[model samples]
Target: MFGIRPSQKVLLLWSTPVDAEELQAMVGELKSVVGAEGKVAVENVEMLADSSHAGSHFDLILAGVLPPFQFENSLNVLGEALRILKPGGSLIVRTTDSATTQSTLKLTGFTSVSQPEDASLTDEQKRDIISPVSEITCLKPNFEVGSSMKLSFAKAPAKPSANTWNINLTDDDVDLEDPDDLLTEEDLIRPDPTTLKVCGTTGKRKACKNCSCGLKEELDAEDEKRVEENKKNFKSSCGNCYLGDAFRCASCPYMGMPAFKPGEKVKLAESTLQDTS
Candidate 1:
C-alpha cells in the first residue's frame, strides 16, 4: 500500500485505461488518505513520460495500479517521475518485471531502489483483483538538482604566538641616527652665488656671439652645475619614470631611458651629451 499522508501531493500513473468505476474508486481511496488539504492526480505512463510537469511538485508517485500495467519506455517514464518529484520524494512502482524495473529506476537516478515484501491484504480486497505484482520503491536524492554548498577541506589558520616580534615599538626604543646627522661637513657648506658669473668682457649675464675671453667655457661650466643640481633635486611627479620610457609621461625628463630603481642616479650616454640639433 502507498503511504498517502495528509496534506501531501500524489501522482497516480497507469499504463492502460481502466473501468471508470474502478478508477474513481482508487482515486477516492487515495483522496480519503490525503484529506482535503492534499491533492491527487492521474495520468497514463506514456502521457506522463511526454508531458511537462513542474519540478519538485509531488511528494509521492504510484505507478502500475488500478489496472495491470507494463512500461513501454521505462527509462523516460521513470526519468520524468524523478524530475517532477520533490527532493527526498518517494516513488512506488508495481511491475511484472521486478529486476528490469529496479535496474531502470537506478539508471534513471533514483536512490534507495528496492523491492519490499508483499503486504498482507484482506480477503475481500484480494478477491477484487488478481495479478502477479512486483512492488519497487525508490526516493529522489535528499538534495535538489543544481544546488551546491561550499566545502572547506583545508585546516583552520593557526593563531599568532604571544612572543611575536613587535613592529610598533617607539623610535626611542632603538638607537637610530637622525637623517641630518648623516650629512658631512661639505654638505653643510653652501656655495657662494657670486662665483656663478659670466665672462667680464660683455658685462652681461649671457655669453658673447664671438668671444676670446673664455666666456663660453665659463658659461658651459655654470650650465653643467645647474644640470647637476636639477638632477639631485629631481622628484617624479608621475611616479612611473623608474619603470622606463613605456610607463613615463610625455613630459618626463627620464624618457627614452632604461628602467632604474627609485632614488638611483641616471647618467646620459656620451653621444646624447653632444648637441646634434
Candidate 2:
C-alpha cells in the first residue's frame, strides 16, 4: 500500500479507457487515506513522458498497469517521473512481470527497488491477470518459465539540505577579536569634498550623499540649488527626468504607474515619484 500523507500531491499515470476506473478508485482511496488535504492528478503516460516538470515535487507517482507498447522507450517515462519527483518521493509501477520491472528500476537509478511477496498479493490480483498484452505470451527478457505478475516500488533518495555543512575546527581556528575592530581609524574616516569628482555635465543627476569619495555637506547647497531650478523647468514626464523621452519608466508614479481611477483599498506611495534609475 502507498503510504500517502495529508496535503501531498499524487500523480496517477494510466492509459485512456483502460483500467481508468480502477486507477480512479485507487486515487480516491488514497485521497481518503490523506483526508481533506490530498490532491490527485490523472494523466496519460505519453503526455508525461515529454514533460519538463523538473521540480514538481510529487509525493507519489502511481503508474497504473501500462502496456509495453504504449511507451516507445521506457527510460523516457521513467526519467520524466524521476525528474519531477522530489527527493524521498515514492514511485509504484504495476507491470506484467515483477522481475523485469525490478531490473529496469534498479538500472534507472531508483533506490530500494522491491516487489511484493506472494503473501502480500491481494485476492483479486492473485485470481486474475489484467494487462493489454497476455502476461504469459509477452516476450520479456529473463522471463522465468512460470513467473507471476506483481507491483514494484522504489524510493528516490533524499537530498542533503542546503543549510547543512560539515566542517572540522581546531583550537587554532578560534578567533576572539571583534569584527568591528578589524578596521583602522583612517579607513573609517570620510574623504574631503574638495578633492572628489562630481557628475556635473549630466542631463539627469543623482542626489549626492556622504560616501567614501566625498563629504555630502559640500554638495548639499549645490544639489538644493539644482533641485529648485529643475522644478521650475519640470514637465509632466517620467520622474521629472529627461530619460522619459526615450524610455518609459513603469515604476514612475507620475507617468507610467497604473492607478485605479477611484482609489481602491490602498494608495500609491509618494516615494514612487522619485527616479528609480
Number of the top TM-score candidate: 1
Which stretches in model 2 have alpha-carbon errors above 4 Å?
Answer: 51-56, 65-73, 119-126, 130-277
Q: Where does candidate 2 clash, by residue pair?
A: none
Candidate 1: TM-score?
0.51
TM-score of 2: 0.40
lDDT of 2 by residue, 1-277 (tens): 4557788888777765465566667667877776677777777887885555546467777774433312222776776776667666777765555566566666655676654333234556555545422111111122222347755665578898899897889979986799789999998899975445554433223334324433345466787788656644444454333333245454333344444333233333556434344
Q: Model 1, range 160-262, lDDT digits (tens) per residue?
A: 8999886988878898879999999999988876555555666766778887767678778988888767655667887888999899987666778889998
Clashing pairs in 1: none
- lDDT to native, each model: 0.78, 0.56
Models 1 onward score TM values of: 0.51, 0.40
Among these predictions, the greatest lDDT belongs to: 1
